[model samples]
Target: MSASSTRPSYAAVLRMPYATRTFTAALAARLSYGMVSLAVMLAVSRATDSYTAAGVVVALFGAASVFLSPLRAALVDRHGPRRALLPMASLYAGLLGALAAVSWRPGAPVPVLAVVAVAAGACTPPIGATMRAVWGELITDRRLLQRAYSLDGVAEELLFVSGPLLVGLMTGFAPPAAAVAVSALLVGLGTTAFVASPAVKGVAVHVARAGARTRLGRGLVQPVVVAAGVGLSLGAVDLLVLAFAEQRHHGENAVAWVLAALSAGSAVGGLLNGAVDWRMSARLRLPLLAVGLALALGVAGLAPGLVTLSAAVAVAGLFVAPALTTSYLLADESAPPGGRVRAGTWVNTAVNAGSSAGAAAVGLLVGRLPLAVCFAASGAVALVAALVSWHGEASPDVRTGEAAELVR
Candidate 1:
């Protein structure tokens, strides 16, 4: 296909056989992720009446997830999605149930709750990586694959936007435990459907060579690290935005609106990015977008009011999805043969770790420094990501119907 004619419309991508069903099921599974941490925090805090205990529990869960997600993805890469994801789903659901039960119990020890949270995080299914791998299997055309990844990015932004809203509504009308229970239900149903989807079942399984190493080596490591820095900036931005709203005495609703604006910009940018056929390689595009993100965020740090901050945030967010899409593409192109899912998982893990780090660091500084300083710190982190990605090895050009050979 010619370059101009190669970009597939969103509807065209969705209309592929089994595409809609697989995407919907994967979205359902992922939606729970947006709520699980917050739900756990609320439930634990309600039961213990201590934010410190709640924070510790949440931190343990995040730490477990950061360490375990890549291993789960490696399992999926080795055993195939159906064989790997279904069992993990069951374990995760059971653990979530255990967590809910513990939270509901009177006088449950904080240590016990923390242990359950860690186990629950460790068991969380590798749905995100598996779904991306499935897309790689389903779409062989490079342009179509790009569009699919872009669509996935947009869907992810939507999940973050709606997931928190769903939790808030559930907790508002019912007990905090209700939110946790609902999250478990959603994860159970969604993961089951995802594993059973025709797209997943139809994808070919890749078995690694016996005695092969599993960890990311040279080519794949840089992009994953860059992705982590991007994630750190993202997490810092989130905390800063919330702090900004609070400092201004804007209501909680205002915080939600500001976040929504950011999501909306990302979604729109992803759509536009996919609709065009860019000549630039993923290696170049990735850093360029990251630079844009850094600059926009830096400007956002200077905003004097809610409206100005929202505008700056929206502008910065416009680059978020595109940069992420490019990073995923770069990671995929650089991954070893039969290791795509593993590589994707590592990227996810790094991002999560960076976010956790950003949140922890900024939380400490928020009380002492100006909120705008937090934003500036986030921008600085993003600038670091941009520089790192720019200096990384050049990615092989993606060609229509051509399988990308693993780059050394």
Candidate 2:
């Protein structure tokens, strides 16, 4: 049988020794991230009775987390997951609990709430980066590692989707503060289990600390740039899709369906991308995928109505996960030996910053530009990033090493 005809690689990823246990713990802990933002926002609003106050507090929290992510990841890389993750998670969870307690009662001071939330976010464990580094340590085959990253990305996508749902369910009967508390508990338990995993123990002992001491080099630029572009495009598309729906006389709820189609398409694309073992290098494939996403999103703005827009959006979504998964792989390969966590954190931070900037930029443009022009502008962001990456030739060593064959 052909290699393509073999059993699914995803199952093989799970079956790797201690992979299942370690991964589940990471996911459980990571799910807290998905829950915390929504939970905190609702809780703070309830406490302060002002949406403005809540938004500011949430923004401060997010800014702290995003800006400090590299530093947190570096700690994990330098001291290993056990030494680094445990203290961070513990402190983060404690702050979450404290925030929940303060938010439980109405009329809490806004400044107090913001201070605690920022502290919590700053202490947020570098769980996602650490987990990716673990995947690197356990999976030796580059193909298998790609599959692992793909699977991890898809699972995380779902977690974010479900996290809010989980919180919403809790808020249906319990207070929003209760959900925040639950998030705290989840991270605490999950991190404890994660550190206890044999794989992490082994990783702590064998992984080189030398890479952690050195700075991440220029090899990370393309992946970070492309990832930021992907984020910008996706964020703008969310608003653009809504604007398109509004113009077409579609109800607000209809936009959700279109967005859901995008999500489904991304999930499917991530899986298929992982299943393939391509011959082209990731460095080459990275820009092409970004371009593919750009083109699909550009077509989306021209759709006649909701149906056509949904289809176009779905097509755009198909490239989302694949592009990000490829970027993460590039980050991993380009990172110093033990600095994979820190490198991945940089890519993650860029994606987030880009998303925020994209949303703000679109909010401004929606009032000024034609919707089609706005859509094209969004796509152009990714196209520009692709052009930059395409022209920026890799060093000879990188071209032959981490940027090895990943596409046709």
lDDT of 1 at 387: 83
TM-score: model 2 vs. ground truth: 0.94
Each candidate structure's TM-score, on Cα atoms with residue i matched to residue i, is: 0.91, 0.94
User: Highest lDDT: which candidate?
Assistant: 2
Model 2 clash pairs?
280-406, 280-407, 281-406
Q: Cα deviation in Å at residue 357, candidate 1? A: 1.0
- 343-385: candidate 2 lDDT, tens digit per residue: 8999999898898789889999996998888988999999999
Write one digit per residue (lDDT tens) for candidate 1, span 254-280. 887788888888898888888888998
Best by TM-score: 2
Worst 10 residues of 1 by lDDT: 395-404
